[model samples]
Target: MSEAFVKGCEGLPWWRGAVIYQVYPRSFRDSNGDGIGDLAGITEKMEHIASLGCDGLWVSPFFTSPMADFGYDVADYRGVDPIFGDLGDFDAMVARAHDLGLKVIIDQVYSHTSIEHAWFEESRQSRDNAKADWYVWADPKPDGSPPNNWQSVFGGPSWTWDARRGQYYLHNFLKEQPDLNVHHPEVQEALLQVARFWLDRGVDGFRLDALNFAMHDRALTDNPPVAEPKQRTRSFDFQHHYHNQSQPELIGFIERIAEVMNGYGARFTLAEVGGEQAAREMKEFTHGQDRLNSAYGFDYLYADKLTPQLVREAIASWPGEEGEGWPSWAFSNHDAPRFASRWWGEEERPRAVKTALALLMCLKGNAILYQGEELGLPQAEVAYEDLQDPEAIANWPLTLGRDGARTPMTWTDSACAGFGSTDSWLPIAGPHRAMHVAAQEADAESILHWTRKVIALRNAHEALRCGEVEVIDEGGDLLAFERRHAGHRIACYFNLTAAPLALPEVSGSVLLATGDVAPDQRELAAFSALIVETQ
Candidate 1:
């Protein structure tokens, strides 16, 4: 490694060019034999996470919740749910993770709270209550209709009639998750208190869930109809989503959150932004030094196909520079189908898995790896009866419920796929068992091993970390780009097609390869990928 490369990384911000491995707490690993993975389970698996050479772990919500939205509907921002463990377990986990040199970033769902949350419950009781304005409660129209035409992402109208308050409260998701009225000064203070609570507990950072939805137009203007055709199956796609989310006022609130984080020292905040204007909103959220550190959208996570054109477009969407915010990329997460099954047919799953990992790691900006991704686990096939996600159930066969992605991580090939002593909360059958962590760990050339090496290789070079990405050429099934930082540059390539292709002439040293390259300049095998450092 060049000294300039080492110097570039040493001075880089903790998250600027870091790799964060995402852990969906419910599916990572179960340690209490309770069928569900908990904080304790994650704490026990710190070694595996640290071994990946990732800079940090972005754990999904484990806060006290009603489980209506799984952990997303938080009941207590300051406490852990009994199902996941208590405050003591959380503190211990943080301590252990820090010891392993891993920054711990927990989820902060500030946009809404479970109906069971005290703040929401109190706010819903009466219009005259002290917390009446804590939530987005508005009087109904003269005909007892909703105040606006906004719709929820989950499926129905955004406003729900509250008998006790004689008004309708806004809910961007399930009714159980009522949107918080961040416009209220007290509400902002309360949310800041929630952040301070975690900061005091020594958390390294936070992954702000649905950040764009945190603030809405106080005038409650109706969202305009989408002028363009919708290609996605999401309910929110039907409208323009103008007033309901991605409000301009959200930037000020994000700055306030960043101010609070800055007081805590090197704390990072990443927003999960998505909607019609995701790219613009993401850049806005992270535009200044005083706002969110970074933001990730649905660009890759929700993509149904992995093509060179799509990859180029997604990366080019966000131009990282002096003033613009950084972008974080993820191919799969708890909310989307596994990329392996989404991108490749069942027959070519293995090659697709290896190629996907290499492609993700080589991409500029922070990379997030979901649980079980390293093990090359394909999406679990959950029957309709077993489906737990409300969106999936509502959309049925058209959308595979998120439960397919939430299946317990197969640790061993034993009963329950070593997820637990009893049957896991979600079944662990099919291709998951053969691709368990234990099974793959024993194979030196497995995807899991390659992921580790890819991460290590990326870490060793500054060009692949926080460099500017320039698309050299994206034609046919081959995708090529160069990541440059200062004078150092590295070219990364991926062959998304099934048949082999001739290697294009390039001036670079082979740093890593997901497959063997033939001397005869034959076509690249199905789904092959490589990273080369330019001379």
Candidate 2:
């Protein structure tokens, strides 16, 4: 078995500097050979995750969903999707993860649910049913347009005219995912029950998905338009999303969730927030004594370029101070494009991958390492015919599409890359076999090995885990910072570009270094990252 999972400093919480590997359930593995991944598959792969030296695993939603929004449209909170596995399989997976000393954190999309949900079904039946007000419903305008100018993140108006209720319903995402009316006391109580259900199931924590969208203004006010960019992607991009989301009442509900989590021992909760005001809302959602443990903003997720300034700005936001919530960072995840493809050129990717891994570990907040990242996998080339993601399909050429990042994992050089025997849901990446786990294990110098080494180093050093990050330099291609905690300090330097350069006088013992650099050498190779033990 892998080394027992170690967390943070004694007084600090376990999640403070934890490195959690995100496993997109469908793309991780397939045990039944049904061309789809399941809980059994995740169970079989727990060792692979633990072996990576991550403290825990964050499994994407496998709840009963119609696959309309690819499991984000959860239909039943208590049941596992048949395609993924049953409750028995889920229990076994959680047990195995604990045995390997890896905590299991699952996705909870509390903001919305599948339109087919029992709550929505009964609520849409009439205006005064037992659960009629559980969902956001309203009357259409006199002209028969939506009730307001709110827009869906997917496309079109946020309000959908439902014939059943004879009123418009709110859905910030796809119509299949109707927004939950958190204003109702009953809805809040039921969601708390859902949280309690998962905590009792041996799971260690939760990643609340699109949490900022949980509540909206009851006034049905029209969102004002924003100007500037000539080209817009979707209707949601046309206006500032002030009215439809990020309400003041949201904080109380978050505190309520934290209250539920406190009943379970050492349980962690993180909010996933995005969009224009994410930075401000993240602070609001996670701040204070009773809110969530931490939160992540989309600072690096949609970044057009990887500059030293971008890295500096993102890390500078989360200062470890009184009343400020802890920060979490995700360079890559299920929804966003792979960082390697987004930030580096082909020839530079090999070195850049290792440097980025070290950089992520050096950051102060908890990190979410996407699955297949250790293998240095790029965005898969998906043919138009094999497209599965609805967002990609709707926009086509306009968007880079999330489908490219959701492909199957490559485990071998065999016919199907070990994900399954038959054709998988999304095709395996063309170049993925070269960096498969089997091949990486055979090569000690592989990025996979480097990733394991860096994660181990981060865990061993207290400064890297529970320290305050002080930016030392942010100029040109070079970025440097020092992490300090309880008199222990580590200085991290990185050459994030393809151009080789000479380094300044290096002091302290070299903890971990990538590229051609002897102990006495001062020159840094292209895309080199080195961590030095500073006095």
Candidate 3:
């Protein structure tokens, strides 16, 4: 649990104050030239992840599925999808990651399953089957409409009629993905067993996906309309999601999951929480010792801009007080637009990207780095004809498709960006092809190398890793904060605007700085960041 670094320190949990790399399986790398990344591909790139100084890697789902929602809809919890390779492949990948001293965390979607899952199949067969109550099945209203006013996240009604059962089944996502009856004791036990299965298979942890949707109000009450209806293209955004999700009962199920994970020893569990009540729900989900270790919200992932106020508010939400859960920060991920694309202009991207990465490492929580973020890869321009996200396809020009952010990783300057011999499933951006790993590896001043340096600096300093944070300034265009642990103190300052800002008078030794920012400088240049160790 501990690694020797600075003097006077204790061993910390592997996940505490660690940086985790996120890999979207279908886009990270392709093995066998299948145009889709697989387990073997990720295994081959394990060295690259380890080289980044991240403590671990979180791999998105690769379970048995028909790809209805691209692997988020699981068909079998125990089986591996043929396209991504088999159990043997997964085991080999885990072994390789362990050999590199990296933890492996896999996504677990407990809230729902594919319609093709055995349990869902049996549940839909008849009302008297062994697994009849395995899924959420409700009868229609008087006029044969859906039982309630709940809406699916992918758009339209949350219910789909099954002719054989003569009832409507709840699906928070696509109709092909049916919500599970997690409130049932048997269902809870079944999910716990699934957790144990993976733990036994040597997975270091699990990232619970859409955990707030795990349970619904048993009464099936209609969700009331929002107080002020904002312009929204999707029906799901019109109502307050009171009855459909975020039930208090979800804590009970989370405890059950905790019990299973605790038995395995030192296993990490994090939840992917979203929606309006995300802050409260995230705290609740990881509130106590018998709950999840950490949970991340969409604070930065979906933000329109990265400002000092946003960072301050987000960090304040989880203040590391008594009983408060640890927070994990992610600037970019599979579901959100790349941070570089979301927050900066094309001309200022280089400095802005480096500043953001340094700030993320300096924050007082675990940091999550998306697959291509170290290379400063922007959102790919996926044409409407090539779009593959169901939500983006359904919503069209209204919503920027996630396909733009999930493009295949750029491995080389070759055609197809060396992702595979064949064309990638998602087109590699023309600009991204030029920012390939091979080119960056050859350039000493590339963002990839800067990323490694910042991560290493964080690892070397206890004050930055697991310290108490004190916000000094969070005013417009400038953010200043201090990280304190033991007798070591470090200060971080960021210039979040395009104009120069005079540095506050301070005395310290320069530790790390981005964009020509130095301790001797009196003012920070546009989009610059400075980190220093105060004596």
TM-score for candidate 3, please give it: 0.98
lDDT of the candidates, in the order given: 0.85, 0.87, 0.91
* Position 318, candidate 3: lDDT: 76
Ranking by TM-score: 3, 2, 1
Per-residue alpha-carbon lDDT of model 1 for 284-370, expressed as tens digits?
899978899889868888777988999889888876667888889998899999988888888898878888888888888889999
Predicted structure with the largest TM-score when compared to the true one: 3
| Cα RMSD of predicted structure 1 | 2.1
Task: Tell me the RMSD of model 2 versus the true structure.
Answer: 1.8
Ranked candidates, highest lDDT first = 3, 2, 1
Residue 60 accuracy (lDDT) in model 3: 96
Q: Any residue pairs clashing in model 2, and if so which?
A: none
Off by over 4 Å in 1: 1-6, 227-235, 518-523
Q: What are the per-model numbers of colliding residue pairs?
A: 4, 0, 0
Question: Per-candidate TM vs. native?
Answer: 0.96, 0.97, 0.98
Pairs in clash, predicted candidate 3: none
Per-residue lDDT for 75-188 in model 3, tens only? 999999998999999999999999998999999999999999999989998999999998999999999999998999988999999999999999999999999999989999
